[model samples]
Target: MGAGLSGLACAITLEKHGISPAVFEVRERLGDRFVNAESMLSILQKPITDPVAFFAEKNGIYLKPTASIQRLLVFSQSQKAEIEGSLGFINYRGRHEHAFERQLGRQVKSAIQYRSKATYEELLMEYTHVVVATGDGEYTRKMHNFRTDLTVSLKGAMVTGDFDRYTPCAWLDYSYMEKGYGYLLPLSDTEANLVMAYPDYPENDRLDVDERWGLFYERVCRDLRQPLRITSHFHVTGYPIGICRRARIGNTFFVGNCFGALMPFLGFGQFTALLTGIYAAYDICGKGAYEELTQPLRRSYENSLVLRRAVERLDNEDLDRIVPVLGSRWGESILQGKSFNALRWLAFALRPWMTKR
Candidate 1:
C-alpha cells in the first residue's frame, strides 16, 4: 500500500504478470527523506553471493547498487580489523537522484497516490487483495501481529569527507552508548553516510543523543584521520525492530518490514523486503504460496535474533578479542564460504563467549 521499496517492487511484479495495481505512498514524492547509504552485505546473504544478480536472475527484479563493497573495516574499543573481498554492495537510500526508492519508482507503470491517507480498513472494502508495505510495523502492531524484539534510537548524517568508495567502516564502542554501533558507508570519494544505532532501553531513555553522536563523530574522524563536515542529519527514536507473527490474514498480504523483513543482527532488510513483495505478487498470480515463499526469510530473521541476543551479552572486552578474530583466516573462511549458513554458525560460535562474560 506504500511506494517504498517493497511496495514499488510489489507493483512492478504485479505489472510483470499483467496485473495493474494501485500504489499509495504517504510521502509527497519518492525519496522524500534524509539521504543516506546502506550496505547489502554478501556475508549476510550467504549461498547467494551477489544480491543484484540473484534478484534479476531469480525474481526478474533488477536493481543497481551504488558500488561493490570490497573491504570492511571494523573497530572495537581496543582493536581494529580489516577484511577484504567482494563483501557486498552499497545502495543510496532516501532522497537522492539514484536512491533505491526512486530506482524502484521508475520501474513501476502505475501512478502512486502521494500523500495517501488511505487506511487498510477502507482499502479492504474496495480492493480484492491488499498488500501492506507501509515500511513499518505500526499497522501490523495494530492488528496484534507484530512481536517487537527491541526498539532502537538512530542518529545519522550525510557527511563530506575523504572516503574510499569501496570500503565501509564500523565501530563497536560502549563508552558512548551501550550495545550500540556506528558505521560509515561512502556514496563516493567525497561523500558518505555516517550512522549510529543503539538500543533504546529504559535505562537509555534519558541518554542524550547529541552527546553520543558527538563522541561517535570524533571517533570516526580520528579513526579515518579525516575531519568530516555534516551536510544533513536525521534522528529517529524508538524505531521497532521486530517481526509479524502472520504474513497474511485473509486476502491481506504484508511485505517489507511489515512482515518482519528487518533482521535483528544488523537490521538490513532490503533483499528480504524485495523478495517478500515479489512473493506476495507471486501468490496473487497463483504462482506460489506466500507463506512458503517467505519461510527462508523468516528463518534468517530468527537466526539473526539469536545472534543479536548472544552479542548483547558481550562487553567491550569481548569485542576487543572478537574483532581480531573477524579479520583472521578462520573468520575470513566463514565469511567467504558460500556452502554453509554463516549466520547460523556465527550465532553458534558465540555461545561459549556469551556464557563466559
Candidate 2:
C-alpha cells in the first residue's frame, strides 16, 4: 500500500506478470526523508557473496551500491580490532537520486498516488487483495499480530570527513551507552553517516541522548584522528524492533518491516524487505506461496533475536574480550568462509547464553 522499497518492488514484479496494481504513499515523493547511508553485509546474507548481482540475476531486481566494504574496524572500551576481507557493500538511503527507494520507484510503470490517506479498512472494501507495506508495524500491531522484542533510540548525522569509502567502523562502550553501539558508514570519500543506537528500556529512560552523542562523537574523532563537521542529523526514539506472528491474514499480505523482515541484532533488512515484496507478487500471480517464500526470512529474524538477547546481557568487559576474537584468524575464517552458515552457528552457540541470562 506504500511506495517505499517493498511496495515499489511489489508493483514492478506484478507489472512483469501482466498485473497492474495501484500503489499509494503518504509522502509526496519517493525517498522523502532524511538522507543517510546503510550497509548490506555479505556475511549477514550468507551464500550470497554479491547481493547486488544476486538480486539482479536471481530475482530480476537490479540495484547499485555506493561502495564495496572491504574492511571493518571495531573498538570496544579497552580493545580495538580490525578485519579485512570482501565484507559487503554500502548503499545510500532516503531522499537522493541513488537512494534505494528512488531506484525502485523509477522501475514502476503505474502511477503512484502520493499523499495517500487511504486506510486499510477502506482499501479492503474495494480491492480483492491488500498488501500492507506501510514501512512499520503499527497496522500489524493493531491486528494483534506483532511481538515487539525491543525499542531503540537512534541518533545519527551526515558529516563531512576524510573517510575510506571501503571501510566501516563500529564502537562498543558502556561509558557512553549501555548495551548500545556506534557506527560510521561512508557515503563517499568526503562524507559519511555517523550513528549511535541504544535500547530505550526503563533502565535507560533517564539517559540524555545529546550527552551520549557528545561522548560518542568525541571518541570517534579521537579514534579517527580527524574532526568531522555535521551536515545534517536525525534522532529517532522508541522505534520498535519486532516481528509479526502471521505473514498473511485472509487476502491481506504483509511485506517489508510489516512482515518482520528487520533483524533485531543489527537492524538490517533491505534485502529481505525487497524479497518479501517480490514474494507477495508471486503469490498474487499464483507462482508461489507467500508463507512458504518468507519462511527462511522469518527464521533468520528469530535467529538474530538470539544474538540480540545475548548482546543485551553483555557488559563492557565482555565486549572487550569478544572484539579481539572478531579480529582473530578464526573469526576471519568464519566470516570469509562459504562452507557453512556462520551466523546460524554463532546464533546456535549463543542461544544457551541468551537463555541463561
Candidate 3:
C-alpha cells in the first residue's frame, strides 16, 4: 500500500512477473523525513558480497549507495576496541528519495497516488491482494495482538568534526546507556551523524530527549576523545520495534518494519524489508514462498532478541568482557551472518535470569 523501499520493491517484483501494480504513499515524496543513514551488509558472508549487486543479479532490482563504512570503533561501557572491517554500505536517508527508492522509482513507472491515505478496509475493498508496506504497521499490531515491543529512542544531529569518512564509532554501555548504544557515522570530513538508540529503560523515564541526546553526544566525544560539536539536532523519534505474529492476514501481507523485519539486536531492517517484500510478491503470484524464503531471517531476528535480553542484564564488568569478543574474528563472523556461537550466546541470554530486579 505504501511506496517506501519495501512497497516499491513489492511493486517492482510484481512488475517483473508481468503484473501491473498500483502504489500508494502517505508522504508526498518517498524516503523524505525518515532521517538516518543505514548500513547494508552483504547477503553473502565470505568475500563480502555487495547487497545491491546480489539483489541486481538475483532479482533484476538494484540499489545505489551514498557511502561505504570501512572501519568500526566499538566501545564497551568503558573499554574501547577498534577493528578494520566493512561495517556496511551507508546510504543517506535524507528528507527526500534515498538511494534505493530513487533508483527503484525510476525503473518502475507506477502511478503512485501521492498524499493518498487509504485504510486497510479501503484497500481490501478494491484490490484483490493488499501488500501493507506502511513501514510501521499500527493496524496489523492491533489485529494480531502482538505483545513484544522495544523502544528505539533515536536522536540525530549534524556535527562539525575532523573525522575519517570511513571510520565511525559504535558505543555500547549498559551503565549510562542501559539497554541502548550510540553511533557516529561520518558522511564527510566536516559533517557526521550522531545517533543513539536503546531499548526502553526506566532510568531515562524522566529526562527529556534533548537532555538525553546531549549526554549521549558528550559520552561519544569522551570515549573517542573527539571534541566534535553539534551544529544542530533533530527531534527524537522513539518508535517501537516488535515481531509480528504473522505478516499475512487473509489476502493482505505486511513487510518492512511493520512486520518487525528489523534486526532485534541493533534494529537494522532494510535487508529484511527488501527480502520480505520480494517474498510477498512471490506469494501474490501463487508461489507462497514468503515464509520459506524468510525463515532464516526470522530465526536471526529471534536470536537477536535473546542477545538484547542478555545485554539488558549485563553490568559494567560484563560489558567490558563482551567488548573484546565483539572485536574478535568470532564476532566478525557473527556480524557477517556467518555463524553463531550457540553456547556463548546462550550464556549471555541466560545471564540476565541469574539476577532478579
RMSD of each: 1.9, 1.2, 3.3
Most accurate candidate by TM-score: 2
Instruction: Choose 2 or 3, whichever is better by TM-score.
Output: 2
- Each candidate structure's count of clashing pairs: 0, 0, 2
- Taking all chains together, each candidate's TM-score versus the true structure is 0.96, 0.97, 0.88
Q: Residues 1-357, candidate 1, lDDT per residue (tens digit)?
A: 888888888899999999999998888999798888988988887888999999889777778888999999999998999998899999988888788899889889988899999999999999999999998888999999999999888889999989899999999887778888999999899999999988987656778879879989999999999899999899978888899998989999999999988888888889888889999999999999998988888888887888888877789999999999999989888888888777878777776765576
Q: Model 3: which residue pairs collide?
A: 32-96, 180-198
Q: Write the per-residue lDDT of candidate 2 for residues 1-357, one digit (tens) a residue.
A: 888878888999999999999998989999899998998888888888778888889778889889999999999998999999998899999989999999988889999999999999989999989999998888999999899888888899999999999999999887777888999999899999999988887767778879889989999999999999999999988888888898999999999989987899888888888889999999999999999989989889989999888788789999999999999999998888976789888898988877786
How much lDDT does candidate 1 score? 0.89
Of the pair 1 and 3, which is ahead by lDDT? 1
* List of clashing residue pairs for candidate 1: none
Rate residue 238 of model 1 by lDDT: 82
Task: Tell me the spans in candidate 2 whose CA falls farther than 4 Å from its real position.
Answer: none
Model 3, which residues run further than 4 Å from truth?
42-49, 223-225, 329-357
